[model samples]
Target chain A: MIHFDQVSKRYQSGHEALRNVSFRLAAGEMAFLTGHSGAGKTTLLRLVALVERASRGQVLIGGQNLNRLAHRKIPYFRRNIGLVFQDHRLLPERTVFDNVALPLVIAGARHQEIARRVRAALDKVGLLGKERLHPLTLSGGEQQRVGIARAVVNKPPILLADEPTGNLDPELSREIMGLFGSFSNFGVTVLIATHDIELIQRMNTRTLVLSKGCLVDD
Target chain B: MRAKATTPHFERGPRFQLRAWLLRHLQTLFSALGELTRSPLGTAMTAGVIGIALALPAGLYVFLDNVQAVGQNWDGKVEISLFLKDQIDDEAASRFALSLHKRSELRHVQLITRAEALEEYRQLSGFAEALNAFEQENPLPALVLVEPTLRYAQPEAIKGLVAELGRLPAVELAQFDLEWLQRLHAIIHTLKRGVVVLAALLALGVLLIVGNTIRLGIENRRAEIEIIQLVGATDAFIRRPFLYTGFCFGLLGALMAWLLVEGGLWLVRGPLAELASLYQANFLLASLGLRASLVLCLMGALLGLAGSWLAVRRHLRGIEVG
Candidate 1:
């Protein structure tokens, strides 16, 4: 579960990225956030992931206020959430399986468990056969799929995607959305931030729209 | 029920967690080694610099040790001459010399009767034939040549021993080559201090070299580090591989330095022995003792670890999730 109770964020350069944004998504609920290029969609997701702290108010996940989390606990707290980026952010030096296994490795998983979980996550992303291949050798869509596999590999309760399909074709984007839908059905609280209105309509799920630095519609 | 049971979050037994922790450390350590292998030339260059830095001080120290050994050898030969009292006869002087040999401090005592003293003086002095003018009176007094044991031959110890011998009733006066011994001890002391100072400076150099290399390593892996941190890896977890990298660098550098020093000693051993033989002295080049070599290696590794720790602690703080 994720909640933003009147949260706001401002950069060091006096740029207001978010202003009094408020929203909540219950456990197992899937939603989309739509906004223009500089409308703070990324900033809002960053707050949920605790990658950026709110300048004001609280951002809570599963009832734990992230603002109160100590710096030392930040990494461990991140174990409970998953994030996927538009550029895939997969390590090109490692194999697809290793990229997915990063989270489990960070969690200190046993070798057998890491292998099993990585294979299972790769299967979920329809990348089970490409586990041994390098990310650079894979197509952009496959690379993005590997990133998704990695995000969910730790079995995080919540998953956040930031323009995950930005570089993909329409077909690939739909497929990636379908993968997110499947994850939502499996009880993961999925939230995707993208301004692709047509894709959001095709998603046909609950959508929140942002304008400038405020949540205009939800 | 099946989904809950099959979730990746299986029950973590205490033993299982312990094993995971061990596995993680080993993996990181080995991965650091693998990373070195990935860029062999770079690693070698960094380690080579550390090796040269380490070897310089170590070589100088070994040289100083050998020089000190030579000084000690020369010190052992220093003689304290006890000119017997005029009333003392050759028999009395011989008795005193024999008694002096019984003391633990004196290694050797040679009694030179008044006749032998005159003969030795005649053999050395250019006015040898003129030395016999005292044949009737034999003005050269009966003498005892004293050689102290190696330990007592040191400048401070020899001073006390000479003073004690000088106070003997049968002895007229004790004469020791004090000025030369004093100067040798002073030079040895200065050389020892110089070795220590040089070692410390070179150690600091090693630290700087290791730190700069580790900084470069961190910079190269900056992207990966950010990603790892974002994916829930703790600072310590992120630092483990780098620490191991530093450790490996230090260990390798120390090994290189050790080899360099030993090889240098080996190459110079024959020539040094030959020079000693030219002086009719049995001297050999002193390689570092086993303990000293081990300490040097350990020091190298520790410096490497310290340098990397400094580099990582400073730079990791500069990196934030935002």
Candidate 2:
């Protein structure tokens, strides 16, 4: 579950990213956050990632207040949250398997467990046969799938994807959205931040829309 | 497919946790080693700097050790020379010389009365006819020649002996040195201090060299590091490989320095031996013993580890998950 209570974020340059935004998602629920380019969706997600602190907030994930988390605890707190970037930030030099297994390696997983989890993740993304290939050799959709596999490799309880389908074709975007649907089916809460209203309409899921530093509709 | 249906919660026992801990460290250690081997030239250059820095001090210490050893073996340079007062008669000086023969330090004590002293002085001064003019009274004092055993002939020990003899009622002045021995000791002391200072400065230089290298390495890997930090890698996890790289550099540098110092001493030993032979000495060059080489290697590795630690502590904060 994620909760943002009266959260506001203002950059040091006097630009307000978010203003008094409050939201709550029940445990095991999935939803989409829709907003314009500068509507502060990324800032909200960044607050969840603990990458940036809110100017005034009580952002809570699983009932733990992230605003009160120490800097030293940030990494461990991230262990439970899976993040997928818009550009598929997989290390280009690494093989698909290494890219996926990175989180487990950081967690000091046993080699056998790492192999099993990584293979399972690759299989889920339908890239099991391309584990040895580098990320650059893959198509954009495939590269993003690799990124998804990496995000889910650790089986993090919460998944946050920022514009997961931004660079894909319509069919590929549908496929990627379908991947989120699959995870949501089993009670893994997923929050996808995107502005594509058609995709949101096609998925028929809960949507929270932001406009001009405020939540305009839900 | 339901995600939790196919995936049971991944949990581990304590034993598995321990094994994971061990394997992770081994992987990082080998990975760091691989990074260095990927660029042989760069690693060699860094290690070479450390090697030269370490060798300067180690070689100086080895050289100084040999100098003192050789100096210790020079026994025949000088011995105790006791000058009796002019008031002492020939019989009294002879009695004192006989008493000196009872001491273990004095190997041979020769007594020369005033008559014998004047006669030797007449020959050496080339005043035989002028000496005949001093028939009224011989102005030369009685002399005692005391040859000390080799064991007690060290400058410090001889000085102690000279002090003891000067307190004698009949002795006027005590001579225990070749005069050059005191000056030689002062020079050796000064050189020892110089070597210590040089070693300290070189050690500091080694730290800076290693620390700078690690800092550059951190900068070069900035992107990878940010990615690592993003994916829940702790700072310690990210720093592990760099620390190992520094340690490897230090270790290899120490080995190279040992080879350099030993080879250098080997080259000089031939010439040094001949020179010592010319002086009728049985001196051979000294090399770093196994214990000393082990110490050098340990010190090199520690310096490397310390340098990397310092660099990481200072720069890791600047590289937050930006």
Candidate 3:
């Protein structure tokens, strides 16, 4: 569903963050993006998310070239793509239900549908009872689960996770990865960027590795 | 299958209605409002600052308005006084008054004969016995009290007419009681300019107050905003809550200022009424009227909105989501 054709990104400080990186993920595919610290993994995902424009190459999502899309239209494009961070990124002041329902809210879903979908998403992540609780009240693993629930709540076709398990212990990381794997089985395209080699081996997913601002392996 | 059927129907309805877009984003707006309400003390403090800043100029404005209303009543009392030569008799003064009555500039003219003037002066001065002791004659001149037409009541026009009357053979001197009016007009004009400058300076103060508040709010929410952006939230979406916070502060401030000004007016109303009674006048201190109040509210809102917009536009650009 996403294609990066030799995409390159450069900062104004003369640092080339991504140099001629190219990759493609088929529809409903699950993949892991492995890279060390200061690697171009985040930049690659950001390009697909259309947060940063490729300096000299095309980044395509769902057959639309993101580099050519108008800035005002970016939000509309983002409505179909879900992003999760290592920190979970749930609004600290809001309840789990509200955070999970945010994307649907942004998409202008009906209130009843939002309630229903948020409940179902929370249920799927084993957070059904914590709907009204704030993120700070939840454990790190539970918070990440809430993040995952939020990411998939809008039923976005593509889900991107950057270091979703970085802050978790081995057991919690396994649980989060299993949750992602379950989402893939539901036909949601999943791409996770992580540095955990052991976890990557256990997941048995397609792996793309990057080093020093360049994609070294796929 | 039921879920699929419901989904398409739900999806179709939103596609046709533009209001759905706003309704869909209501959560974001409500979330923003919730954040503002979360810290009631901080919110109240910021709003109080805005209110004080706005009330200073608004109170001065009301004062200027009251002054103008009182001044308007006295504008009609302006008139010119013609003093005839000491040798000029009552008959000549009466003829001169009659001549002046024919002029378009003269609204009404009354001839005060020298003997009648001396008799009135004796009555007013409590000098009846002293005047009788003088024996020969009172040296007071025959006077003409001339009320000018409203159109010719202005200082320049009255001055021109007075100069013309001064040149008349029977006239010794001509004076208009416009000196006080002229002084009042000059003072009001200067006060208006001063109020404008003061309002401008106070407006800047309000901007800075609101700007600083928003800046602090942004700093507090910096991490959350970075995370929001990382999760594909646009700058507009991230900035929405702060803008709403600023607007709320401004709106609350306006309400407080309105109360402050009204309270001040109420406190002084009784004394002002007594002062008016002393002058034997029915003067009412004017309050901030509907239009002025509306303007004040709108100004407060704009100040808040503009201040937040500036703060967000400047600061948000520097934040990069990792």
lDDT of candidate model 3 versus the reference: 0.82
| Regions more than 4 Å wrong, model 2 | B1-18, B75-100, B104-157, B160-179
Clashing pairs in 2: none
Error of 1 at A196 (Å): 1.3
Classified by CAPRI criteria, candidate 3 counts as acceptable
DockQ of 3: 0.28
RMSD in order of candidates:
4.5, 6.5, 4.5
- What are the clashing pairs of model 1? none
Error of 2 at B162 (Å): 4.9
Best by lDDT: 1
TM, every model: 0.87, 0.84, 0.83
DockQ of each: 0.42, 0.31, 0.28
Task: Please give, for residues B167-206, the per-residue lDDT of candidate 1 as tens digits.
Answer: 9899999999888756877887898888789888988888
Q: Candidate 3's error at B283, in angstroms?
A: 2.4
